[model samples]
Target: MPAITVDDVLVLPRLPRLDPAATAYRPVRRLITAPSGYEGEGFPVRRAFAGVPMPELDPFIHLDQMGEVDYAPGEPKGTSWHPHRGFETVTYIIDGIFDHQDSNGGGGTITNGDTQWMTAGSGLLHIEAPPEHLVMSGGLFHGLQLWVNLPRVAKMSAPRYQDIRGKESALLTTPDGGALLRIIAGEIAGHRGPGSTHTPITITHVTVQPGAEVDLPWRADFNALVYVLGGKGTVGTERRPVHTGQLAVHGPGDALRFAADERQDSHTPQLDLYIMGGRPIREPLAHYGPFVMNTRDELIKAFEDYEAGRLGTVPAARVPHSHGQQPPR
Candidate 1:
């Protein structure tokens, strides 16, 4: 069979009309400042909620802020072959390009604003690396990869992949056109995201124009948090100010209000925020590097499966595709 391209798996969610009567929800949870770490051969990464064992943050296991770093020519870095099981990987590229290939005959290039959702159900071996051109002439690399866990019943399901084009995302502008919200996995302003998820989750990328404010609503059952990608801003009813590289873990509330620093600064552009949450699975978690299962026995079985080559293999038809081909806007 020919390799399955991203276009084949891309699915758009039906956009919904906004409910004008929707009540406002403010963030009230504890704040968590993600710590910096390294992954994929010294590539810098910020470990968010998953690094810490917070039962409040379930289903959503780990979130990594990948390189916002500028690299010189020949300094490009990335992850080689690795294995994963029992979770879904959501990779969102903000600046540069990422080339990925997996054991299930899934491979593709994701550039600025694109997202790749890979479900490592049962097991899978994958490689996430930079394209050769980028390695030859480096530039700024910025993106985020989040790991979403599967329920016990779905843990051993067949692996699947979906590459969502940025343009397919539902974009909504504030009434005054001062801010924009990019919905990737949930409804915002009644516009739905592009992802088909086993777990109920919401991932929204917000751009707050200088001196402008925006409000977003999330389900009361979903545990929510906001991660600052750039500039500084106040989040929640308390207006707790959070800056770049900081994560604001919201308390129970139905809606979140984000206001960029009111004092406009041409040098600062605007505030970049990523708000994500989902209904907690509330199950026992046995996690090891690259594996997350309900029990240690299950995790052991996963490793055994991968070792025995139970996970399917990438088809021999792995032809390389050019990168930087942004989806049609």
Candidate 2:
């Protein structure tokens, strides 16, 4: 909720209104409520992309809404060392702190609306956890982790990392100054975010005030999706009702329409949304656990590589705790 914001939205650049007669607004194709689940040492999460067909979620495989949880002392949890290949992991923190370390010497502490992007293009070992002090004191934690797939041509690219601070996002407002848009990656209205991507995509976080609506221009060729992070709202021109933990997939169009309800719960003063879309890869996908590939043989090779320690060794510092903790296939 404390992600980048402004004292007065009217001061920011506003989205230009589009012609109603010419603008083709995307229609809501499906609405799904995410199922609750657990991940990485028992941290609570919501499976944001569950029950959706792969073609509809092209270039994106998994998404987890991590904790709106307030942990008691000693209750904090995190992932043990693990391996991933052929994809990217994007962790965005809205209200908490997280420390991350990968075998590639990419590790840091990010908190209060920061993001840690890890691209396990070929393969790598990584660990994510709370700092020791936070584990002892406990506090609020809320965030999201999204898995983005690389095209076949880039599947074997070298792993990389990008640390994006919340302030680096491009901030904009709706025409009436009733909503805020934070562009995290890709471009919107020609204003691009700080993230660099191998694929063409756009990821934005939207916060709408009560009774506010926004008609956003989108790429006609890219897929469109919106997921509710919290609060209540309606998506698309049909105004299909949506609330927290819901995801809406939209049909082809040149724009999207959504608005927050006039009344919101006390706990949620605004309608928070995570919107993303990308050009579909459309390539054959063979996936198993953390490895995503184009063929079953490629998947088998991935597993074999990991077991054979060709996926990179766990850092010497973590050998003590990461040994024998290989994630089950």
Off by over 4 Å in 2: 318-329
- Model 1 bad stretches (over 4 Å): 1-24, 50-52, 264-268, 312-329
TM-score of 1: 0.87
Measured on C-alpha atoms, candidate 1 has an lDDT of 0.77
In angstroms, give how far residue 115 of model 1 lies from its true place: 0.1
lDDT of 1 at 45: 90
Q: Which ten residues in a row have the lowest lDDT in candidate 1?
A: 1-10
- Which residue pairs clash within candidate 2? none
- In candidate 2, residue 162 scores what lDDT? 98
Distance from true position, residue 178, model 1, in Å?
1.9
Please tell me which predicted candidate would have the highest lDDT against the true structure. Answer: 2
* Per-residue lDDT over 59-102 for candidate 2, one digit per residue giving the tens place of the 0 to 100 score: 88888999889999988878888888998988999887888988
